[model samples]
Target: MCTQPAQTEEHDVSTQEENLSETDTALKSIIADVLGLEAATVNEFTPETGLFGHLPELDSMAVAGLLTEMEDRLGFIIEDDDVDGEMLETYGGLLEFAHTKRVEA
Candidate 1:
């Protein structure tokens, strides 16, 4: 019953960029949420921070949950083969993963 006017492809691309920024922010937020960690705590999450070593909250199950949230929220599927423990090891790596998705999209 409700329809909006179509946008130009350029407009759509701009919207997608905004959405990607939102996704990055949401990724951090969801990481904190799923990890049951304070936002500030995740501010400390860097690529070399040792996700598994540093965060006791991050285990196999949590990893699965995080991946699910990412897939659901960002509209991008994370293939199992696309990542490994090393990629989740730090904030930089996580950023890299997100960047990869944007590039792939």
Candidate 2:
């Protein structure tokens, strides 16, 4: 019985990891598509990859379009105030934010 429970826990963790990976992939695709970037470029992004100030495609004019695309792709609603600089500062931050929204939905 103890071993069975452990196996079940492991499976759950694995499933969660898979879901996070899928979410990350989807987010990268969305960002790339919205910003007119190559999918290959977005695929190279790591947790530390800079986004807002570093990416010329992510300027003020593009933020709204990006958020709208994110909402459309992720099937989540983003409020006006939820648009913050830190949320788009790095690839990890955006992934975390998207995951949180996914969980909340």
Candidate 3:
């Protein structure tokens, strides 16, 4: 008797979402590395948690470091308007911004 192979399930996210997810992952890794956060991973910090305030490791210097790292990693320019705390209010927001920038670039 012949046996049938098991079928695999796949997600149906849009291409934009997939690209955003990839960018988010990279951003999360960089954030974790730069801030030395102990949240286990970037997902630990939600959009509600104020990164600069909630994350002790995310002071001014750390923010600057993170920004620089992001610039180099994403291969794009960060404008002054992009420095608003709102842009980084949460992981979701950051990911959204990154995706937007990626498309713009």
Per-residue lDDT over 1-105 for candidate 3, one digit per residue giving the tens place of the 0 to 100 score: 234344421332355578777787788888878877654766676656566666677888888888888889987788888888777666667777777787677
The candidate with the higher TM-score, 1 or 2, is 2
What TM-score fits each model? Answer: 0.70, 0.82, 0.74
Badly placed stretches (over 4 Å) of model 2 are 1-11
Residue-level lDDT of model 2, residues 1-105, one tens digit each, is 123466588886787688789889999998888778899988999999999998888878787788888889888999978778889899999899888787667
Span of ten consecutive residues with least summed lDDT in model 3: 4-13
The candidate that achieves the highest TM-score relative to the unseen native structure? 2
The clash tally of candidate 1 reads 5
The per-model lDDT (C-alpha) reads: 0.75, 0.85, 0.73
Clashing pairs in 1: 46-90, 46-91, 47-90, 47-91, 47-92
Clashes of each: 5, 0, 1
Q: Mind giving the per-residue lDDT tens digits that candidate 1 earns over 17-61?
A: 886567667778989898888988876665566665567888889
Candidate 2 has which clashing residue pairs, if any?
none
TM-score of 2: 0.82
